[model samples]
Structures are given as structure tokens and as C-alpha cells.
Target: MKNLFFSVVVMGLAACSSTPPAPDWQLEAKGSMDRAVAAYLEGNSRVEAAELARARAQLSRTGRADLLGTAELLNCATRVASLVFEPCAAFEALRPDATPAQLAYANYLRGQAQPQDIALLPAPQRALALSAGSGAADPLPRLVAAGVLLQTGQASPAVITQAIDTASAQGWRRPLLAWLGVQARRAELGGDAAEAARLRRRIAITQGSAADAPKVLP
Candidate 1:
């Protein structure tokens, strides 16, 4: 759970048969995502506001354009999604791609796209989940992979449990918060309201602690 804004256009381009050159709007949008990322790194709030403005502008112009380039769009969508906490929009922006990884990530992201109670995913996404390997398999890669797993329901129970355990042991707050939310959502989907509520409470507790501390891991 480090905030990642993968370009929708990047995903689309990777998944599509023919690659498209980056459009001007997309370049601008990409710049926004970069700026936001940099700002997040520098702990500068103003830069995030600036990037959010630029991203929304790009999204407004590109949202309805038919045949928008996928990779660029996904990149843009991911940025926007993070800003607004809207993963559905991010996934919709990826509809043109058919790759298993992309599909699984899209689904996983969609599951927790919003901040509340969710349900079982469709079959295609489930199928996609079956094929997903542990993400890039490094810390950053694991997060990327974990995000995909969280999104697609491909994440092994042990992996999620281990993530929770590791976060507790290492005192990594944000990932723990995110994992807590994801687990709660999954529990709710599985018809375990009590379990989901427990996870939700953990999320609140972790978030409270995180608010007052410097993050060791996102």
C-alpha cells in the first residue's frame, strides 16, 4: 500500500495489440501523477493539491473520448483514483486491456475501490486471479503484486495474514491499515459481518497510530 498511480494508458498500451503515442493531455496527466508522487515523497501538501487539479483536468477532457490510449489512461486513472479513492473509475479506464495481470489487478482494485462493504467478483476476474503470481516479488514489487492480489482476489490467505503479521512486527502502519480494510471487505463479502467489523476496528486503531507517527513503510 504505498500509493501507486499506474497509468491507465500504460496498462491499456501494454494490453492492446497496437501501441499509441502519448497524447498531450496524457503527458500532462502523467506529469501530474509524477508531481503528486514527488510531493507525497517530500511530504508537501501543496504539490498534491496542484497535481490533483491537473489530474482532474486531464480526466475531464479524456473521460468520454472513445478509443483513448489504454496505458496512458490507466496511468492517469490510477492517479485520479488515488486522489479520490475511486478504484472503479480506475478499473473502468482499463477495460480495453485483456491481460490476466491487468484484469486481476483491475478486479482487485475494484473490490476495495470504494471505502465500504463489497461483494463477490465476477467469473472473469476470478479466472484472472487464478493465474496471478505473487507480484513483482520485491518490496515495491510485492506491493504492486499485493495490490493486484488485493484487487483481484488472487492474494493467498497466508500472504494477507503474513502482511498483517509483518506490519505489526515491523511497526509498518499504512500497509497494515490498508490490509485491515481489505481483509474486512473480504470478510464482509464472505458473509462474515462480525469478522469484517473486527477488521474495521483494527483499521481504525492502526490509522489512529499512523496519524501520530512517521511511517516506516507505506
Candidate 2:
């Protein structure tokens, strides 16, 4: 996910001996998906919206509602990595047309997936989709893994710190602030006032607000 090589997902495609020529949608979707993710994590909402719209349009070319739903799932996944927990309303609108695989992925993203859902997940997501653990080395995957762990009631201080460090190292302000906020909250709950203040300072610096950092974890 961090490297973004696996950004575009060609939903409902079965593996074949020889890969066929890439579809126009696949090519366009991949680039758009990559940019959308980078823009979202880097805190550029305008670019993220435009790129995600472009990717959705490309996926719509196939006339498969499931693909459209999958596009929304990808968008929600990026949002989740940045600690956004709103319902995936876009995917919900297309749910009636979605396949079991699509539903499985939706559940996986929501932390309500079943054991069967793991196989339906993209490779980078499978490890965390399966349990309370991290998998890939890429910063995005780790951030995603940390997000899932937090969702599943399994995140520890270490998980939050790692996610914060990963986002900071990548200069991903959105997730960096989000994760820092979470760490600060945890520190507050644990009576580590000094650590909490330090993290709040970092969050304030990022957001240009000296006020109390907003709650990003609930």
C-alpha cells in the first residue's frame, strides 16, 4: 500500500496463465488510485476528491456495480488509514449490486469481517485482516494494519507509536496528526501526562492549532 504498486484493484477478475492486455480502465484507475491515496494521506483533500472521482469514473466503464463499490471501498480504506471512521455510504448505495467478494471486503474494512473474508482481501491487507498484527513493511500497509488493530480493540501503545512514526517519516500530515492524537489520548488515559502533552504539542504544530486536539480515535 505504501509503495502504491497494488493501488488499483481489478475486481472480479480471475487469475489466468497469461495476463491479458491491460484495460484502459485498469491503467487509468491505477494512476488515479495511486494519486488519490497520496493526496489523501498527504492532506490534500481537493486533489484526493478529484483523483478518486476519476478513478470511480474509470471503474464505472465496466458497467459493474461491484467495481464501483470496490472503488468506494478503496476510498474508505484510505480514510480509515487516516483515522476516519464514517460509514462507507457510497459503497452502501451500490451494495445491492455488489458481489459476495465486495461485501466481504466492505466487512473487512469495517472490522466486522468473518474468517472467510480474509481470502477476499488484497494481499497487503490480508495479514491484518486476519488478526491483531502487522504484515508488510510499507508505511501504508503498517498504518492500515495499525488502523485495523485499533478498530478491533487490539491496539497497544506500541502499535500507535509505530503508526505515528511511520506517518511522520513519510510526512503524511493527516495520518501523522491522527495517530499522534490517538497516542496522546492513550497517554492521557494511562496517566502519562508528560507524554500526552508532548504528543499534543506535535499535533498542534501540525494542525496550526494550539487548542486541544480533536478526538480522532472514536
Which candidate ranks first by lDDT, i.e. highest?
Answer: 2
lDDT of 2: 0.75
lDDT of 1 by residue, 110-190 (tens): 443221211232233333334453322223223333555555556787667755665565454545555666667778889
In model 2, the runs with Cα more than 4 Å from the true position are 1-21, 208-218
Candidate 1 to truth, TM: 0.40
TM-scores of all predicted structures: 0.40, 0.83
lDDT (Cα, 0-100) at 48 in candidate 1 = 60
Worst 10 residues of 2 by lDDT: 8-17
lDDT of model 2 at residue 210? Answer: 24
- lDDT for each residue of candidate 2 in 158-210, tens digit (9 for 90 to 100): 88888888988987888988888888888899999998888777776887642
lDDT for each candidate structure: 0.47, 0.75
